[model samples]
Each structure stands twice: as C-alpha cells, then as structure tokens.
Target: MPLGPPVPERAQRLLAQLERYGSREHGQLAVGRRLLAEHPDLPLDGFMISSSMCPEPGRPLHSLILRVGEHDTDGITAWARALATEPIIDGARHQLDTILDDIGIWASATISEADYDMDQAVFIPSGDDVSFTHRGLLVTEFGEDGDLLFSGHPPAREVLAATSAYYRDTCGQRLRAFDGRDLADSITRGWCRFVAYPTRTDWRIRSASQDTPGALPVTWMYAQEGDTQDLGDPVHCPACGRSSRGLDYDHVTGQRVHLCPSPVCRHQWPVDDAPDLEATEHRQDQRAALAAH
Candidate 1:
C-alpha cells in the first residue's frame, strides 16, 4: 500500500524525469540559470529543490520552489507554463514537457521592497561586541563571549551599494569594508575595528578608538532657534577636554550637546560652546589689522 494518497501516474513520470535530470552534475545550477535568463523581469531571490519518498513502496516526489518578489505571482506562473512547452534542450523538445508534467512547482513571494531598503541597515553595539542587521535580518554578529555567527549569505550587492551610498550621502559618514570571518574575529579581539557598512566585495580594514575612524557620528538632533553650529565638525567636551569627532549627540539641560566619546568620561557640552576655529581666526586677523593701523 502507498503511504498517504497514491501518486498519480503523471506525477510519477515527472518524478522519474527529475531524478534522472538531477543525477547529472551541475544539473540544478543549469536549471536555475536557465530560469533566470528566461525571466529577466522576475525578481528571483533564490530557489530550493526537495525530494521525498513516503509510504511502504512509493515513487519519489520532487518539488521545485522559486522564491520571488510578491507582485510577480501571475507572471511566475505564466513563465512556468511556458517553460513546460519550451524546448530547453536543442534536439529534445518532448524531454522538458515530459518532465514538467504534473511537476510540483511552486512560487513563493518572499522578497519584499523593504528587504532592499538602505535605511534598514543598522549596527547595534552591545558591550564589547556588536551585531549588524538589515531589515531585521541578522547579517553578522560578534559576541562578547568570542562567538561569531553569520547569516548564510551576505546582503545583495545592490543592497550593499545602496546602503553605502545612504551612509555616505544622507548620514554624512564614511564607510570601510570588511569581508569574511577572520576580520570579524579581529574586531572582537580589538586587533581592528570597522563601521557596520554592508559590503561583500572589499576586504580592507582599519583600527581606531571607539569614536575615532570608521565610526558613525550621531547626526540626528532637534535644533533650537538661533543654533547655527555645524555639528559635523568635531567638538571638545569642556569637562573631559576630549574631541567629539565620532561621538553621538545628547540632550542635556534642554539643549543639544556633544556626548564625550570616552566611556569613563561621560561628559556633555552645549553645541554652541564648541569652538569655531574659522570665526576665531577671523577675529584674530581683525585685531592684528587694528594694531597695524
């Protein structure tokens, strides 16, 4: 007796064809590439193939699931139907049709617009370690306990490029790229450090203090009236007397201030109090001119 429902004759034939095709080296890759080439308009994220054999004596059933963007359901279905009739191999027109007969092909709309949002790329620092996430999906994580975890694949190249552009243009921050697990381990060990800009191509890395090079400066702050200070310039904390180059903004005493980068210092100074080097130099020149006169 077959387990569950008896496999239909067409399904059996399809399964047999799939098994035969999959036995060839790089067969699955070839199919995926063909699908991608045929449907250039389709936003194909990826795909999966699975086979199952159930019941006491049953023919193996194979399934091909295509992951795509949500709005392309009808388009994907139409393409699949066309693929069934299309001659994939040059001399064998019936081969592909026979294999597609009653084949378990499914389209899943898993990729969304938000998945490519550059703003969704964020780095969360926790104690001595940090984690990088895009659209709430963990890309890579460095644990304080010296544990490292990575999401199977890096973010898409376009997504990473968009994120890099966003940080550089919108956030007014510079980015450095780090690839592979070895550099990530170096970060945890303090041999090097990097900002959480998403890139898979570059392998360059650099080291700096907590708020020095390769750090994202906090640029979000509500400006009070008549406050024309350029927050992009580094400020020195009066209390700590340390430069606030990569430090974040803080609200203290009902005004925007530069939070000292030093964890031990924890000092804040009013934004207006930050020295204007240009203005000071201009004033000095005026005084010198008056004395010359």
Candidate 2:
C-alpha cells in the first residue's frame, strides 16, 4: 500500500526530533517502512536501548543495544538516546535539531508552553532491571482553544503525576551541571541533574564528559513577582487577580512576567519564570496596557 500523506510527515517529525538531540544511531528506513506497514496510523519516533543491557557495560560504543532509530527515528530511538546522556542546562531544550540538515530535514520550534504552565519531559522505565534505554521527553503543547496536547502515552493518573514531577525537575529544579569524562562520571560525579532517564547500568560511557564536555550549567532563577501568591492563598493570582480557575503562570521570561493565551488577559506581560516585584509589576503594567488597548 502506498504511504499516506500524514505518514511521511510523521516520519519527518520523528527524524527532526532525533536530529535535534543528536542521540542514537539512525534507524534503517526499510525497518521503518516495515514498521509503518504494521501500524500505518501509529504516531511515534526514535528507539530505546540501555548500556547495562548491552553485552558490554560502560564501553561507550558497545554498551548499548540501541533499538529502533538504528536507521530511523521512533519511540525506541528517542528512548535510547534520552537514556544515554545527561543534560547539561537547566532549561535548555536538547540540541537535537543540529542533525536535521544532515538527515534532509528542517526544524521548526514553537513555544511548547508558557513558563508557568505544566510541561513535561519523561523517561519511561525499561522493563529490564538492567536496561538503560527506556527514556523519552513528553512535551505539553497547549492550544489557543485552552486545551492540551500531551505527546507520549494517553493521559492517565500516573502520567499526570509523572508529568508534574518532570515539569518540576526539568523546568524547575533544572539540570545545573555536567562533569567528569564519561557517562558514569556524569551520573556519579554530578555530571547531570537528571538521572531518572538513562538508568545507570544501561548507560554506555563511550567517552568522558571531559572528552566532550557540555556547555555551562543550566540556570533557573524565579522572582517573587506577579500577583505574588501568598504562602497560604490557593485560589487566586495575587498580581493581576488572574485566578487559577482556568489559568497558569507563564514561565518564559524575556526577563519579566508575560501573559500568554490564557483567557483572563490579553496582557503584554513578557514571557518568563521569574515571579517578583518586577515580574508582578510587569504583569500589572501589561494588564493595564491591555485594558487601554
């Protein structure tokens, strides 16, 4: 059967995702074609693998069984790569896009979500006790219509909880550092703030972080701004009175509070995670500015 229009587009997106992160070996297009034949409607990319599960552990190249993206991107490839390395920046999106051009693809990034909203990047646990390959990031893309499209598995209780944790840690606590020369050093010696992905054993440390150290530590600093919520207030945004009923705090800071598509305000608040006097004032000024408009 001929591949449908969406099928090619979906493949493109998966490839782009993989390229952006520089994780895992590319998958065989033939395998992907066959897999697509099995589930023509499936929306997935990347593969999954682990170092411990590899015949050799900590050898770098031979440490992982890199499952799917050996030739193409799919869930499996996403899993393998995410589990393989530690992130260096706190709020930096993975540099996966760099590979897109090499793979005959282009990347387009959207603000997946407002800073204060719920967003996630998850690591699915591997079935194998020694597997280091099960991992992936789940991004929450909000629509102008006030709905959410969470990439990954179907929405459920566990998923929600896990997403919350991920949002808190990845975007909140942030991966502050990477160190040492290889995978083990990054994990044991604080080369990364996130260890939940690449389970230790499955990690194949081909080289040390020193061999190819990442950029600077990820930094996440928030202000006490906006309708600064009191320690006890649970019902409203203290800054502009944007309640939690149908709104969330915007985390993207072009240096101050910014109103997103959240209905309460068409305010020009700058997108950011800082919540302090300046952020609050910015929100207030944005609100006042919007009212004048």
Summarize candidate 2's per-residue lDDT along 6-89 as a digit string, tens digits: 556666555444334434353323334444444545334343222223423323321112123222323332432433432222
The digit string of per-residue lDDT tens for model 1 on 70-138 reads 545445545556665432221111112223323344553322323433233233333333234445433
Clashes of 2: 59
Give the whole-model CA lDDT for all candidates, comma-separated.
0.40, 0.31
Where model 1 places Cα greater than 4 Å from the true spot, the runs are: 1-26, 55-60, 84-104, 109-293
TM-scores across all candidates?
0.21, 0.18
Instruction: Give me the runs in candidate 2 sitting further than 4 Å from their true place.
Output: 1-125, 128-165, 168-202, 205-240, 243-254, 268-293
lDDT of 2: 0.31
Clash count (model 1, backbone only): 0
